[model samples]
Target: MSAADADTVLFIPGLWIHSDSWAPWAALYEKAGYTAIVEGWPGQAATPAETRRNPAPLDGVGLEAITEHYARLILQLPAVPVVIGHSFGGVVAQKLLARGLASRAVAVDPGPIKGVTKLPFAQIRSALPVVKSKKNRSTTVALTRKQFRFGFGNALPKSESDALFSRWAIPGPGRPLFEATEAKKTDKSPAQIDTRLADRGPLLIIGGGKDHTVPEVVTRQEFELYDTPAITDYKVFADRGHSLVFDSNWKQIADYTLSWVAAHRVNA
Candidate 1:
């Protein structure tokens, strides 16, 4: 397909990072005749270094605001695009699907949604750096390299994990984390998802086996929550972790995702 005829793919980054995190995957998709748009959450700094230097801009941002931002972006798109998101972004992608905003969607190691009930000890420990401090709800919170290693890069070598943390880590708003955990507390929570919608489109949930933040069990439960089994699928990278998109083997995951999209191409 030529660039004009190619499908548009919107790559949504997760917490603590900017859209630049998707540069590699975006380049790969463009090379394969797709238009890739990498969108950062609202108030994200242009670069990780800048974000680390000043994170106050992200404070007080919540799931509702972030979701609405993406929803508006999708509504303005020239065509219904394929949405791919990781971590928190994954949950937002599902919310977009619920709104009938995507032609297809892929969520990688997505954060907990409304219907997922299992909360593993590892997951709790991983989020403790933020959740343990209520003050973080109004202030930006950044994870230590140690915390990142434990939560996102556990499957990688220490040196690599450290490097990735230094390069991509930044402060993130804490309200979204609180909202995700407290989703069940309210009937009209922003984290709520209607996976059974007939127009929800094709959905793929990808899990990282070694992920402490959102383990395989969590992603599996998310997949099972969708009543339309015919349009929902799940895949797991047995040796990966929450940082699967930034891991050394990220290309493998990217290629697999590309293949999945091609298989479910709207006009294929």
Candidate 2:
């Protein structure tokens, strides 16, 4: 099909990142024959300067709030569109799906939601820098070199990591991490969605084998727990890390997702 006949593609970013940072990927999706839309959370300031000057509440925001924001955005679409999300955005995608929002979805290393039982040690440590400090309850922290080395840099070079830190790194809200960590205790658990939304639509869980934050093992288990008849596909990139979207291998991953949507998503 031509671009004119394709459904729009809405790209949702993970925590600590902005929608503008996704411009390149949006272009790629456009080239693949879809009109692309990149959006941010209500409180997500545009620049680091803005974020520093007016930092928002980290612990105050809840899942329902984020879900509502995306739901509103989804409603503005011409029709139900393919949703692609990463990390915390992945959790948001799950929330959208539970509400029967997306035509299809690609969740890359989605963070655990409530009711998810497996929390890897690496994932915990990657998040400990924020949750460990009481003073950090309302704060956001940039990933340190050491932490990135462990969580996101295992498969990338120091040069690339440094460049990404300079270009893409932003202060992420601590609230979602805290909430997702304590998701098991919450009523809107991952299990609740997994159980209730068994046949909402197709879901593809993409994992990076070298991702320490959402380790491949943890992602695998999360997939198995949640995958139902609606989920029609899955894949793991052996050498990729958590920052798969910007990684050199991202085109292949994006292409795979585009192909999946082409095969499954019905045009309006």
Candidate 3:
């Protein structure tokens, strides 16, 4: 499709992996006549290998900083793009919508935002590795293979889970987690969502039924927060986990998101 006719879809990745995490999704979006751009957090290395080898690049990064980086990128787009984000990137997508930056947004297994009080035991346990350390706020931390298996890859077979961990797992900034944990106490926390905004574009929240990180409970709570359910939608992929984007059934979710965007394209 020509640039003028093509819709831009910006893919925002969450913790651990960089922009490359969205490579497969980008290709799919492009095949559907959308111009896809996979962007990373500020200071994120180009690849998982590079970030694994040197994590200092992500030190001291926080949620607000990452949000600002993405907001700036959205402002530079030719038109308001369809912003799709996974994990913490999902949180950023909502922030962008609050700023009137996206034509539409899809948040998959999104990290919790302020006012989302339902923190399940699984979610807390999954985040313990990062939140356990106060110094992690200023450092980069990598999850152990076992931790990755439990928190992100539990729904997949051992071989596939191991392969995904090897290919995509990398050090992630801890400050974002810290920021999320303290969001309730902080005014204007980055995790705060402006659910009351009437002009905020349509949003779709996708959840994994078996997800240990951002479980269905969390996604449901997020969905209920929207004052206008007409523009907000939620779906759960049963048998999937936090790593749904990298799972074999990822295309199913992608196809749904594409259809949702197509349905709402007239607004763009």
Candidate 4:
């Protein structure tokens, strides 16, 4: 099919990362014969600077709203789109797949979901500032450069880490981290997903071995949580960190996702 008549790929950005950062990935996907779209969360500003200046709208935005936003968008699409999401977006990608919205999904370094029990120290430290108090659940938070370095850019040099932060970082809601951290204990948690959907689209969960924010162990646990007969796969980048999505070599991850989607969606 020509690119215009081919499938659409919806790209979802994770927390603290601007939606516009997905532009490069969108171009890459379009070149591979797919229509690409990247959207921001509910109440999110169009640009990083605008959102940084007035983040009030994003303070209380949580997974439910974000999920609904994408679901509504998916319904209006020309066809069931292939969804690829990173970090919290990863969580949403799986949720969308469970809800029968996407034809196939690739979740890279996704946030911890309801059934994940293991929380590494680095994950805890990265999230403690926001998940420590109940009030933070309704507030917006921005990561410090140092925190970003540790959680996302640990595997990259300081100069590139700083550049990525300056270019793509933005304030985001804290509810996801809070809800995910306490997901197992919360009733009707937004982080919950139906892992037993045997007829749903295929899923590929990617992990970053050097990811401090969402450790590779957590990604494996999430992969293990699926109890269905549906296809579920997991892959790990042994030397990469959470910043794999937007770092200098982000195309590596994007290309892998493109290949996976092509292989799996053929039977989806």
| Per-model TM-score on C-alpha atoms | 0.95, 0.89, 0.95, 0.96
Candidate 4 structure quality by residue, lDDT tens digits, 229-259:
9999999999999999899989899889888
Among the numbered candidates, top lDDT falls to 4
Q: Which of 1 and 2 is the better model by lDDT? A: 1
Tens-digit lDDT string for candidate 3 (1-268): 1122128899998888667868889999999888999999988888888888888978989888998998888777777788999999999998887777787889999999998888899999999999998999999989999999999999999888888899889899999899889988999887898898876778899999999988899999988888864488888888889999876778888888989888866342
User: What do the candidate models score in CA lDDT, each in turn?
Assistant: 0.86, 0.72, 0.86, 0.89
Candidate 1 ranges with C-alpha deviation above 4 Å: 1-6
Score candidate 3 by TM-score against the native: 0.95
Instruction: Quote the lDDT for 217 in model 2.
Output: 85
Per-residue lDDT over 1-268 for candidate 2, one digit per residue giving the tens place of the 0 to 100 score: 1212236777888876666766777998888768898877657777755764575643345556677788888787656667788887877776676666887778888887655677778888888878897566466666776676667666788888776666666667677777777676767543245534665767888888889888888777767776456655669988888878866567878888878778776434
Worst 10 residues of 2 by lDDT: 1-10
Pairs clashing within candidate 4: none
Model 1: weakest 10-residue lDDT segment is 1-10
Which runs in model 2 stand beyond 4 Å of their true positions?
1-6, 57-59, 189-192, 196-198
Cα deviation of 35, candidate 1, in Å: 0.5
Clashes in predicted model 4: 0
